[model samples]
Each structure stands twice: as structure tokens, then as C-alpha cells.
Target: MLVIRGLGSQYGRISVLRSVNLVIGRHQLIALVGANGAGKTTLLRTISGVQKASSGQIEFDGKDITQLRADKRVKIGICHAPEGRHVFGPLSVEDNLHLGAYSRADKAEIAADLERNYAMFPVLKQKARLPAGTLSGGQQQMLAIARALMGRPRLLLLDEPSMGLAPLLVEEIFNAVTELRKRKITILLVEQNANAALAIADQAYVMETGEIVLSGSGKELLGNERVREAYLGI
Candidate 1:
């Protein structure tokens, strides 16, 4: 449902993503695994239109969106849950979620999706009236993902969803992601946890120094000698 060809981006003169190419079929979970500086997050940001592309093309479904405005991209069904859990500190948890649906005008569907998000993260429902900053780290992460869902995204870009969470919370978050894919959400997952990301991904890519180094089935990459030694520490 999404295609990126020869994608390149930079932070001023410093290049971050170079000649990157990737595709995500409908309802597929595509995991992108790489080290901290491999430019996984930059690739996602460029796709979501938050960061401008220095070169190359980004197409969603079919049309080119390389130069689309960030908010327009969200309206076109590209939603990003960024690296940090940047929730509105003073807003109520429910309000933050409501803000996600600001681009849409379907009140009935928005309300229904609100319940769906609440069901997805019961903690958010319990803390509906509380300030988002009051929630625990794990809960805040849940809120971030749930808020993104409120936008009714077709292609969800999740970056470091499990960063800093406890092991159990990490498991919970991954399980929730799996559930999301099962419901036909196409996802581009950028994760530091190689093992977990590869295990759940339908397809996976390995990036090094701003370019794709390997692309294969998730299990194939999981068992690769180089991948095992470098990312998995096996």
C-alpha cells in the first residue's frame, strides 16, 4: 500500500537516508531494524512528510506524496507514532486522543473509534480524565499508539514503540501491534529490538549507514549469521 523508491534525506549537509527503497503491501507488518544511527527514524519521518526528502520519491497507494504537507499526509491515511512519547502534558488523556481525530468530521465514527482505542488500552480509559503526564511510561506509550489510531490511519508508522518499557510492558505493546495487523492495518515498524521485531514481521529489512543492506522474510533475517552476530547478539 506504500512504496518508497531511491529515498534520500539529510539534516543540512549531513546525509541521513540514502537511496532507500521499500514497499509495504496491504495489511502487512514490515519491520525495519538497524542500529541507533542507521536513519530508520529519518526514513519514517520523510515518508510521513514531517521531514523533507533531499531526493527520491514517496508514493502511497499510488499517488506521489514526496512533497505533501505533513498534516495532509495524515489526512491521506499516513499516521506516525514518533520515537518519543510526546503527549500533551496538561491535556486530559481523552482530549489528547480526541485531537488525533481533528482532521475528520465524522462524529459518530470518531466516538466509536474512541471506544475502540479505549478497548485497545484499558489504562487510557481508566485515566481518561487525568493529565497525560500523570501516566506511567508504559501507559504513556500506549496512549501514543492509541492516539495515532484515533486518526484512522491506513499506514501506521511506529518508531521505537517499546523503548524504555519493562519487559512485560514490551510484550504487551508487541501483542497489541500484532492485534492491529490482524485487523488489516498496514504497519511500518522501526524497532531497536531486533529479535521481537523480526519475529513478528511479515517482511523485514536491515539498514546500515543510511541504506538498505538486506531484505528478506523475517525468519530468514532472524537466522542470518551476520544479523545474529550484529543485531541479535546471538
Candidate 2:
């Protein structure tokens, strides 16, 4: 449903992504795994229109959207849950979630989606009136994902969803992501945790130094010698 071709981006004189090409099929979970400085986040940011690409094409569902603004991308069903769960600290959990649906005009649909998000993340329902900043790290991450869902995204971009949580919380987050896939939400997951990311991905890509170095079925890449040594820690 999403296609990126010959994508290149630079920060001033320093190029971060070079001719990056990728395609995500409808309702598929595609994982992008790489170490620090591998341009994974940069690629997502560029796709979401938060960062400008020096050259390349970004097409979503057959529409060329490389020049679209970030908010416009969100309206087009591209919701990004950034690395840091940037929730509004002072806002109530319910309020934070409501903000996510700001792009929509239907108040009734927004309210219904809010209920669905609460059902998806029960913890959010329990903390509906509490300030977002008062929640635990794991809860905050849940809130972030829940908030994104409030936007009714067709293509979700998740950057390091398991970053600072405990192992159990990481498992919970991954499980939630897997559930989202079952619901047919197309996902582009950028993660440093290769094992977890690949475990649930339909397809996986390994990147190095701003370029795709490996692409394969998740199981195929998981068993690869180089991937085993570098990412799987086998």
C-alpha cells in the first residue's frame, strides 16, 4: 500500500539515506532493523513528511505524497508514533487521545474510536482522568499507541515502540502490535530490537549506514548467518 523509491535525504551536507527503496504491501507488517545512525528514523520521518527528502518518491495507496505536509500525511492515514512517546504531560489520558482525532470532523465517530482505543488498551481506560505524565513508562507507551489509533490510521509508523520498557512491557507492546496486524493495519516498524521486531514481521529489512543491506522473509533473515551474529546475538 506504500511505496518508496530512490529515496534520499540529507541533513545539510551530510546525507543520511541514499537511494532507499522499499514497498509495504496492504495489511503487512514490515520491520526495518538497524543499529544507531543507520537512518531508520530518518527514513520514517521523511516518509511522514516531517523531514524533507532531497530526492526520491513517496507514494501511498497510488497517490504521490512526497511533498505533502506532516499534518496532511496524518490526514491521509499515515500516523507516526515517534521514538519518544510525546504525550501532552498536562492533559488527561482521554484528552490526549481526543487530540489524535483532531483531523476528523465527525464527533460521533471520534467518540466511538475513543471507546475502541480504550478497549484496545484497557489501562488507558483506567487512567482516563489522570495526567499523561503521571503514567508509568509502559503505560505512556500504550497511551502513545492508543493515541495514534485515535487517528484511525491505515498505515502506522512505529519507531522503537519497546525502547525503555521492561521485558514484560516490551512483550506486551509487541503483542499489541501483533494484534493490530490481525486487524489488518499496515505497519512500518523501525526498531533496534531485531529479535522482537522480526518475530512478528511479515517481511524484514536490515539496514546499514543509511542503505538497505538485507531484505527477506522474517524467518529467512532471522536465520541468516550475518543477521544471527549481528542482530540476533546467536
Among the numbered candidates, top TM-score falls to 1
* Per-residue lDDT of candidate 1, residues 1-234 (tens digit): 888999999999999999999989999999999999999999999998999999999999899999999999999999999888899989999999998898999999999999998998998999999999999999999999998999999999999999999999999999999999989999999999999999999999999999999999999999999999999999
Q: Model 1, which residues run further than 4 Å from truth?
A: none
**Model 2, range 1-234, lDDT digits (tens) per residue?**
999999999999999999999999999999999889999999999988999999989999999999999999999999988889999999999999989998999999999989888887899999999999999999999999988888999999999999989999998899899999999999999988998898889999998999999999898898899998998899
Query: Model 2: residues >4 Å from true position, as ranges?
Result: none
TM-score of decoy 1 = 0.99
Superposing all C-alpha atoms, what RMSD in Å does each candidate have to the true structure?
A: 0.6, 0.9
30: Cα error in model 1, Å = 0.2
TM-score of 2: 0.98
Model 2 weakest 10-residue run by lDDT: 113-122
